[model samples]
Target: MDNYLEDNMAKILLAGESWISTTTEFKGYDSFTSTKLEIGCTELLESLKKLGHLVTHIRAHDVPEDFPWSKEALDEYDVILLSDIGSNSFNLSNHVFSEGRPTTNRLELLKQWVLSGGSLMMAGGYLSFSGFEGKAHYSGTPIEDVLPVLIKPYDDRVEVPQGALPEIAVDSQITNGLGKFPEILGYQTVTPKKDAQILMTVDSSPLLVNRTVGKGRTIAYMTDIAPHWASQDFMAWENYGEFFSRCIKWLNKDLD
Candidate 1:
């Protein structure tokens, strides 16, 4: 095993990325329902782990109850990522929704955490950014203030069945050793902030954007980390592991 020092390893909190889908099949006036649970960020999780990062994943269903609400708990990780999850999952807790009790606003806590030197990243999906039908609802939230892009108030998904190839928009540490990237099937459309660095783009829209918020940093990857949007080809790219691991390293300030 490689003897890596403690500081070389980053503790990462990964919320969302898993979902359950229910489907009904009808045959000759008889219908049956089947439900399946799927995880979208397995590749990303494995990549981070391979690079020696300790990752804590809170699945979509478990996020409402399991996600950290206190600053001390949130400060335990060097970086946090919200992937394929909505703001409601963090804002509406079980107590607040079911019993109408007041709870700590986790979103606001996250914003403050980032401003205090914690890195944060948001990856796109049907339930990320403005998300499908605007249900994700992070447009004007505190999270948006820390992000490097402006979230659309409405649905932001741009479907590209023909595939949209990722292009390096600027020279940055995140894209340093990364060569030609693979084509992605789709991505959320977001505008880069004035002071934000655009590392990559797809279909001329911001794909990877980075910004510094006070003493911390933030990144917005306007595309899925897994399939449907992250095409099979994109996942299988030779530098797939390197590209993602580099992003985490940059966020943690491990890379200069």
Candidate 2:
């Protein structure tokens, strides 16, 4: 582990990774239903926190209102992690979609922020990177231009019930000291863009990719940070915390 990572803290805004679902039950033609709220980034969040980083999570439902819409507001954080959230959340704020009020375009702001030296990372999920049935819909957004990979036009998730292992594609500080990675259950399918550096892969497909945008940096991890994809063994890996910490350092150019 790098001592610098332990001594220095990076402020990170982690958005999404939460959802609500409802189920209905029937008894003698009468129906009852229940709704539950679930979060998916607990392990990742804990891992980053343990590495001495300050992370503030913003749920998907609150993004339209909570996400920073100006460069000044965004300056508070060094990095932004978008996990399991769609463009719509940032594009259609409550003020605009519901109340017909004018609001800043957060996605465009985020793109400019990255161009001006803020780091950004996008982790995979059903609501990430042209996710399930293409509902995530980041295909033509400004964010797409800043990403290191090109998103597919349709649902990009690839399920691996038998588990898939990652293959190192490039030698870099982020990969230093990294041993065998635990198998993952699934990941998104994306093509690395020109000039983008692929750090890792799963069965020949890109698993982690990154690139520089203007003075900043951006990275894409094509798998969930926690279960349904990350698997129990992955979350419990001995180097989980170190791996994420190194990723942050690399994205911030601290390891360069």
Candidate 3:
């Protein structure tokens, strides 16, 4: 790891699905056909700034027919975020795959990029991991093979009965400082792989999770990284920043 990452600033890819959050608008699909930079990027960047990082954001909002896969476009950052961006933005875009699968070069670059020791954070949303109606399925994608846990083939909604208290699934340095059942406002749930050291859980399923792939690392957030939870936490609790900061530090900690 670089010392500058600990100093005043570090490069970060504050990426998210650059599109509208469609639920019932796209004929039953949370249509990712028109992704946009997630509005939460501002808030997340603000949070990252508190830790001292020069953040850059990438919007895969519009996928032109001649889109190019450039590690130069993504790999230089200290961390890459796959927040709410489903299969369309990275895999199904133009020149990426003719049939919703990543081509060899793109896949190779991504593999090498991570294997060469890049940091990646995978967060969930309606369009993220096995998202709504399986429209953004990952079980069959090349990304699945690189990741430790295989997402389900369908939506794994983190549904809790109204007034239900959010629960912690496992112990980790990530959720170490927070109080018990600290009242997370909202989140998604996934049947994370047993190999994944479950960090938090809702009902026996994983919430915040971590796993390693080659020389790089991966983390999964079963929730939106924005206002719904962020705002709610600010309005209702005190340790939200601590929770979030732990996640970021986990992703970009110095390995030397």
Candidate 2 regions off by >4 Å? 1-7, 27-31
Worst 10 residues of 2 by lDDT: 1-10
lDDT, candidates in the order shown: 0.88, 0.88, 0.61
Q: Residues 104-149, candidate 2, lDDT per residue (tens digit)?
A: 8888899999999999999999999999999999998889989999
- Residue 178, candidate 1: how far off, in angstroms? 1.5
Highest lDDT scorer: 1
Model 3 Cα lDDT, one tens digit per residue, 119-233? 6677767777787777667667766656656788877666443423546666567766578544445566566666666766655556777877778777777766654543454
Candidate structures ordered by TM-score, highest first: 1, 2, 3
Off by over 4 Å in 1: 1-7
Off by over 4 Å in 3: 1-10, 17-38, 60-68, 96-108, 161-164, 180-186, 227-231, 234-237
The 10-residue segment with the lowest total lDDT in model 1 = 1-10
Write down the TM-score for model 2.
0.93
Alpha-carbon lDDT of model 3: 0.61
* Least well predicted 10-residue stretch by lDDT in candidate 3: 1-10
